[model samples]
Target chain A: MCAMTSAQRVFTTLSHQEPDRVPLALNLVLRGARELGLSIRDYFSDPANVVEAQLRLQQRFRSDVLFGFFHAALEYEAWGGEVVFTEDGPPNSGAPVLGSHQPLSSLRLPELAASKGLLKVLQAIEAMKARVGDEVPILGVAVSPYSLPVLQLGFDRYIELLLGDRAEFWTLMEQNIAFCQSWANAQLAAGASAIVYFDPLASPTLVPRSLYQDTGFQVAQRTFAGLKGPTVTLLASGRSLGVLDDLAATGTLGVGVSCDEDLAQIKAACRGRLCVIGNLNGLAMVDWSPAEAERQVKAALAQAGPGGGFILCDTHGEIPWWVPDDTLMALGEAVQTWGRYPLVGAEAHA
Target chain B: MEARTLRFEAALLSMDRVLCRSLLQEAMGEERQLEGIEHLLGPALAHIGDRWEAGELALTQVYMGGRICEDLLADLCPTSSTPVAGGPRIGVGVLLDQHQLGKRIVASSLRSCGFQVLDYGQGLEPLELARLARKDQVPILMVSVLMLNSALRLRELREALGEGPERPRLVVGGAPFRFNPRLWQEVGADAVGQTGVDAVAIAQRLLEESCAP
Candidate 1:
């Protein structure tokens, strides 16, 4: 077989065709900053730095995906909300901007072109596209309209609003869906291959399936339907197997699963419908031995490598900056060694 | 389960707060306020927690149940400063992450069960948390972390607090620890709570163990 470029490998896998090996997509967001010897806050402050760091990281980690995300808080930051970045972990939105006192009526969607921080992210995506072209796939991220309220209103408050007042919840969703469509379409226009529709709150782990069916599931369906490019709905909230049908019904090309789920089961469920992209325990990766990393990669390959719809990735959307370099290196090396199509030692492990 | 408890659990799971409040009133009519919570509300939530663990119930169910129970307890049962006299001092806080839903639920659940808890608040660094726990003389500290980086800091916290009879027994819970079952032990925590209900049970057992010696 001819050697495939990272883009080819990912596209091939998404098409359910055998790539040379399972594509590696280490969700290195903050880790990109770490590679550049800059603070997460400093690295993300400049679009040029974000581009340079991500390209350098792709060179180092050899991941198939170039992340076009800084933090979810950036989405809210564009709405005149504040974001607080720390030395460790992703930034969090400061003191939620929406609640009973403030209300959704007080806010209006900011023009994506005018929002400096979001414009910078789009600029980074455009720059990354120019540099890599179609040789590698750059992924843009947008929090789903159903789940974006977690940033605007805190989790508890959001849940309260969602369950308590249908009118306010739908009104809030209308505003968020508009921003989400605009933001996602802008990224697609900037040359991202697909938008990762991050909807953690949609996961059954967080909300009841019946409630999700009534709220988030329908919102995701509408949001994904409006996106200009391919999308992958990521439920990082855990145990998303129950919603495979609903996620597929959202018209996404793939789903980013959680660590607590079974890869083989998810792959089987996604067969012929959606590509399965994850389940690696990002938390456990912080302390994984090289041997353990290899074992996990082999097991994942064994379970899901039979088909071409699997991309190896961390369960959580973003790999924590503190995960050891050696562990990530081991994960990459193991995929290269054991993840070849017509998978070796697959059955023994399976 | 008894008919009243089952009906109450159903009301809680459905997020019918009004129904839950009415049920609690009915239970209070039959028993003392504390007894109603301990026997009725506590068992209902624990059942929901167990079902969540067994993959039969959603976390939202547990969360809403806890919130409703907290609201009911607050209104129906006036909070006494010394709900349980000489109860082991339990401290709860979220380390490094600002997500407070898990901590809020666990803290409320603990209080519902009549345990005295000192909520040190969220975004506490390891050393700062250690200092606060020590100063408060917290015997059992339950820390919640929404991210793995924060969970890993439990090692630093354990080291700072040190190991001794007087040292607070670390009880860890939240997303990371819940995802990885053995992570609590790995991070030097004495135990891990899979859910807020589990935290209540773990705290009670830890308190009983402490009181034994």
Candidate 2:
């Protein structure tokens, strides 16, 4: 096997082609920075600071892929949702400017290029592309329609409306899907090689399978259809494993499994069609020692690596802010050292 | 058995109805509203929680059953009524390090149970919350942090409010407290609620206890 760019490794794995080694996709953001003795507030507000932090992360971990940005609020900010920006922290979504009872005719979705936070994200993407686009695959993150609703209405209001009204729900879904489609396409146009659609709120843990099918599925289907590049859909919560096959059918390049899903079950459900990009516990990385982090990463590799369709990553999102820098480094080192092909089967390891 | 069954059945039907409403309202938003959830959902969940604590129901059964209840709640109850009081309001929010579900649930439940709940939503900063607390002259500051790291913000908020003549009472909750009960003390919360209902009860109790003096 030869060394491959993280983009090549991820794209190849998604295509089910053999890669030099399993790609390690680091969702580096606030938490990753905290581990490195950097401030989360400082990185997000300053584009240059973000680049410096990301470059530092890449230098420290030598991860297969170096990804930037954190949280799914960027598109929300662009889509008429107000963001209450914190000086040294991730931004919070303000109350929805548009209420549910308001006629669908009232809300016209914003063009992706014209949105607020999106330009910053685009600028970051362009900056990253200029610097490292050739060396690594740049993944642009966007919120799924289902998640966008959560941001716009606030999680509580969104969930309530979902329970209370069905017809209007589908309508909202359509509108959000259109919004995400345009947003994702713009990112791809701006030089993002891949788009990661994060539906953090669409976890089966919160919504039933039937509701997910009825409401979230179609929006996801349409959003993925609008994307020009390889796309990854992250069903961020673990309880969605029961609907893994349903998610895989969205025609995404891969599905990001949460820490709670069994690797074997996800792989079985994916059936070599979609790649799998997770199962390592993000919370553990926050608190575990370096040796422990390495051990967990190695264990994940043993379970998820073999057969070329796995991209090692934290089950969902970035490492939390409290994790030690050494632990994160060890995780990267473990993936680099032990994530080679022909993974020793779990039974053999036992 | 009959009363329990009646409440359970009412709860189940109510949960189903709420779930139906939530599914229909999926377009409205994602936040769990307490006003819509209070009537049947709250009592049912309280019943379920009590039953589980008494060993009358299994954890798996409660979890599975609660998820069914939550799914209904998620759809039906989305958003709390904006706090009505004209006093200094403490704008409580979830730390970026934590999940907002538990906090939102508690905030809404508190609102219905009669506290002026200013839900700052999820992934909020401690300084912002503290600023809101000061601006609102919020008598009680409740911060719900599920992750241990996010819990550190409570201490930061406390420091921000340090030695103030009008510092509000601080309350904290969520899963992290289950293992490390001392986190409430460490984070400088005056009290901590173990569950949503307990949160309401604790807040009320704290208020009552304070007012009595």
Candidate 3:
């Protein structure tokens, strides 16, 4: 095969066909903030700074995808929720909208153009697209309708409502789907090539496998189905094994698993069905030497790369601010170096 | 694990504070809240945590369980005039973890177990822990380490805790401690516990050791 653009390589790999090399999609948020002398607070405040930092990281690493920037509290803030901003970390959803007994119909997906925090995100998407055009695929980030509730209503509180008040819970899910549709449309219109939706609640650590399939899957399926571009879903670091088939059932083109999952099993499960994009232990990438991190990436590639349909990325959606730039760069280098397809005879490949 | 306990667990799962308090009162009949916790509530909460881990329950359910335990402890724990043998004045809080529901449960359980636990809240810096220990003259300091940031700062926290004849004994617990049993030792802690009951046992022993003539 001839040389491929990162987009083509990603497209090819997701199709269960080998490209010249494996594709890489790095989710840079706090990791980039630290490098640019921008605090998490500063990063959330400026669209230009975010795009500039993204381009700098892209130029340095030449990764295949730039997972879009998110302010973490955008939706909560959009819903008039108070977000607690700290100098050292991401903002916390201080007071949940549903902190008290708010009726389910009270939830609203307001016009993005009317909301400042969310509007900034839409503008940032446009900025990244205007700057990087076709250089790399930009993945507009959207919290899955299921996972997004944890922001507006705290995780524990929301789950309480779900279990205790089924009527209100479904209403909340309906609101989420409605919100996601418009939010994703804004991103798609702003030039995001794809939507990377994250819904950690579907993972085994939060909801039962049966519960996720029955409720979480439906919420996600509708949310992903409405997306204007290709979709990739992220599962938080939890017991996700029980829900793989359910995840595949959502009809996302690809799935992002945590670093803790076994790759071989996911590949077998996703075989010729879904693109498998992960399992590089985020901690190992943060703590290990570059060479060790590279080896770890190669090890993940050996299992996830062979038959194609794999992308190299940190299993965690966010890397620690302390994770070194060299370590981040090393991931791209390893994929380009050792992630070639058509695995040779065992001894030679090793 | 009993049907009665299961009923309590179910009520707690739905965030029913009234029913939970009633069930807890029944379970505690004539026993210390610590005893009830160790025997009844603790196991129930642990089971909820298991379900949460197994995907049978949500983290929200676990948090709601913690809240129910907290509300019950408000009535059940502080009223125990009959003090236990190992009761001591100790300071307790989580280090660097905003998820204080687990720590709150641990602190409440310790209070019921007869320790006078200082509620330092979560997001405590190592320096604050040292100051609280020294200022309060607490002989046994219990700090919960759950986040990686807290774990990384353990060595510094140990040094910041200072050295003196009245130096508080450091007893560690939480997932980070369970993740590495030897972590407490690395942080220069006197002991570590895998559970709230174990934490009380370890704290008592450490307190007794600190008081050794």
Best by DockQ: 1
Cα DockQ of the candidate 2 complex: 0.10
- DockQ scores of the candidates: 0.58, 0.10, 0.31
Report lDDT (Cα) of residue A112, candidate 2: 62
Q: What TM-score would each prediction reach against the true structure?
A: 0.93, 0.73, 0.81
lDDT tens digits, residue span A63-159, model 3: 7877566755777777777776655445655556654577656667667878888887778888888877786788887778888877676555676
lDDT of each: 0.84, 0.64, 0.71
Residue B96 lDDT in candidate 1: 79
Which window of 10 residues has the lowest lDDT sum in candidate 2 chain B?
B81-90
Q: Kindly report the fnat of each predicted structure, to 2 decimals.
A: 0.54, 0.02, 0.33
Which candidate would rank higher by TM-score, 1 or 2?
Answer: 1
Give lDDT tens digits, candidate 1, residues A160-207: 888889999999889889999999999999989999999887777788
Residue-level error in angstroms, candidate 3, position A83 = 4.1
CA error at residue A161 for candidate 2, angstroms: 2.2
Candidate 2's clash total is 41
Model 3 per-residue lDDT tens digits across residues B1-213: 788779888888766788888887877785664576556676676677556544466555666566667666766655545443246777887776544545665665565445667778766778987787788988877787654456667677779878877787777777555434565776688787655445456676776676689
lDDT of 3 at A146: 86
